[model samples]
Target: MTKNCFLKESKSFFTLIAVFFSCCLFAQQDDLQSETENEFWRNVQFGGGIGLGFGSGYTDISLAPSAIYNFNKYVAFGVGAQYKYLKQKDYYASHLYGGSLIGLLNPINQIQLSAELEQLRVNVNLDGSNSNSQDYWNTGLFIGAGYRSGNATIGARYNVLNDKNNIYGSAFMPFFRMYF
Candidate 1:
């Protein structure tokens, strides 16, 4: 009779342990599912923007092409190039070529943080000279928040650059972005 009791109790203890372990496994699976639901991927992006120049007295239009790779759900890095045209009244039209690095702080959700660094080259025709031109190169940094839904994204950035040629000071730039 004692042997029977001992065997029964041992079986019950093992059954309890098995139940506990199974519950833990289920919880871990749920956590993994949540994580997979929130991941971003690397892909191509194309966007355009319009902004007012702080000192150049013009409205600028920019075309940007970017490629991004997400390390996880919350972080990504990208590189891209931009072409900008600025029309200033009574001054030479300026063309800008820039390369940029972008960082996405939250790559998975609708709301995210973004930061960018750009190296820009500006070219303008010289006044009263038929064959003369002026060029300038500068660096810019921008930071802001963004919202992404499906393939569409919208964001606003504050830009800071060295205005050595008195071209542009600190300014606010709002942009629209699309990815595929």
Candidate 2:
């Protein structure tokens, strides 16, 4: 074949291959998008909170971490772990560890409602001359409402099942929830 003809054929061949691969890539884009849209892990979020307080011979520390799966625009379900350490000078020391299951609902863009069931194993050691340790479990069922912003909510929840064994002196707890 003539040199010019050979070059022309090669260019045509390369151009055709390029176009074929380009079309293949573009076609796969839709399939990838569709698959990821329904991916379970992709729709899951991680969030939680940490707290610390100190006052004259008194100390409090807490950590709670959680994960949730977004069912849709308005609903999510999650699990969480909690740890708390409290010490009061010449008073007592306590350790609280637990887990929780949480359900969340968003009826509007700015409102979030939640239900949480938590069970904590509490161990306390009384300070001073006659000191002793007590251990037990505390269970709480909380219902709460909050003002919601993107990926976060601030609210308070009230425990409906508060009894003598409950460690938190009150049945009300303030919360800040977030997800990433």
Candidate 3:
């Protein structure tokens, strides 16, 4: 085989191996935490975000729902889904849907660290006689730190892959979380 072909194949092989090992590591760590005193459901939290807005010039709607499992005091994992729609008067409309894999760590009572991997699909259409439509996918990896108080957390995160054309809009974003 050509040298270029061999190199390409090796990269793909290494990526698959890395992903496999990561999955195995997370699974083993979670299993090791099963001995905690709390019941399975007791360690689970459910919450998300909601938004609805309308004006003379625009409309907006959003919904996000998530569930998290606190495997132990230091590690947690979760998943979430999101949907949003926006429209501007006599201009365009957009629809977006996505899901995320979340990981969190709390080393103390007041500080938390988080990571999220998200995959989203977005569709947009212009209005008027010469209208056009486009659909695309966006993936983002965000890392953040936050202050925690009781059941609420507030933080800022930066998306490592954010770009001017990405659905996330900004490389920097703020977040609020609550555990029930």
**Order by TM-score, highest first:** 2, 3, 1
TM-score of model 3 (CA atoms): 0.75
**Residue by residue across 1-180, what tens digits does model 3's lDDT show?**
999999999999999999999999999888768755358888999888998999999999999899999989889899999999999989889999999999989999799999999998998888873447888998999999999998889999999998888876689999998878
Candidate closer to the true structure by lDDT (higher is better), 1 or 2 = 2
lDDT of 1 by residue, 1-180 (tens): 699999999999999999999999999999888766654322334443434455646667767778777676677688888788876666667888889998878745898788889888988875567577778886878888878886666888877654545456546777676655
Give the clashing pairs for model 2: none
Which one wins by TM-score: 1 or 3? 3
Query: What is the total number of backbone clashes in candidate 1?
Result: 0
TM-score of each: 0.59, 0.78, 0.75
Colliding pairs, model 1: none
> Which residue pairs clash within candidate 3?
none
Q: Supply candidate 3's per-residue lDDT for 96.
A: 90
How many clashes does the backbone of model 2 have? 0
Kindly list the per-residue Cα lDDT of model 2 for residues 95-160, writing each as its tens digit: 999999999999998999999999999989898644478888989999999999999899999999
By summed lDDT, the worst window of 10 consecutive residues in model 1 runs over 39-48
Which has the greatest TM-score?
2
Cα displacement (angstroms), candidate 2, residue 27, comes to: 12
Q: Which regions of candidate 3 are displaced past 4 Å?
A: 1-38, 129-131
